[model samples]
Target: MSEEALEYYKAAEISELQDGKVHSREVDGELICLIKLDQEIVAFTDNCTHISGPLNQGEFDGCSITCPWHGARFDVRTGKVLRGPARQDLYTYTVKVEGETILVGLPPA
Candidate 1:
C-alpha cells in the first residue's frame, strides 16, 4: 500500500511520554510500543519477532530496546534489528505530533 493510504491513529499524548522512556498502548486492536527517544516519538509493534515477547516489557537503552524474553535488540527509531535471535526487524509505524497528541500510522484495513 502507498504511504498515503495508511491511516494515522492517535496512540498517546505527547506529554505522556518522557525522554528515553517507552510506553505501551493499544490502537485499532494493535499492540504498540511508543518510545520517546531524544525528544522524538517512535512506534513499534509490541511483540518481538522471534518469539512474540512483549517488547513493551523490554529494556530500552537509549538507542535500542532489548527483548526481555530472548534478548533480541531493535533500534527504536527505524526498528532495525540491532542484535539477534530474531532474524526479522520489528514493525515500525510513522509518528506525528499534533498539539499534545501522538499519532501512529498503520496500514489501512
Candidate 2:
C-alpha cells in the first residue's frame, strides 16, 4: 500500500518523550519504539533484528541504538543495520507529529 494510504495510529504525546531517549508504545496491537532527536521524532520496530531483543530497552545515541541483548547496532532514523550479528535491517515507520500527539504509520491491513 502507498504511504498515503497507510493507517496512522496514535503512539505518544510530545511531553512523554525526552530528547535522545527511547520510548515504547503500542499501535494497532504492535509495539513500536519512538525516539525524539532535537525536534524530530522517529519510529522503529521494538525488536532487534539479530535475536528479537528489545530495542526500547537498548542504548540510544541520538542517531543510533545499540541492542542491549547482543550489542547489535541500528540507525534509528532509517532502521538500517549498522553492526552485526544482525544482517537484517529493522522496519521503520513514518512518524507524524500533530500538536502534542505523535502518530506512527503502518501499512494498510
Looking at candidate 2, what is the lDDT of residue 54?
Answer: 93
lDDT of 1 by residue, 1-109 (tens): 5678889999998888888888999999999999887768889999999999999889999789999999999998888999999999999998889999899999987
Q: What is the lDDT of residue 28 in candidate 1?
A: 96
Candidate 2 lDDT, 1-109, residue by residue in tens: 5679989999999999988888988999888999899989999999998989999899988599999999999999988999999999999999898999998999987
Candidates in order, TM-scores: namely 0.95, 0.95
Q: Which stretch of 10 consecutive residues in model 2 shows the poorest summed lDDT?
A: 1-10
TM-score of 1: 0.95
* RMSD in Å for model 1: 1.0
Runs in model 1 lying further than 4 Å from the true structure: none
Regions more than 4 Å wrong, model 2: none
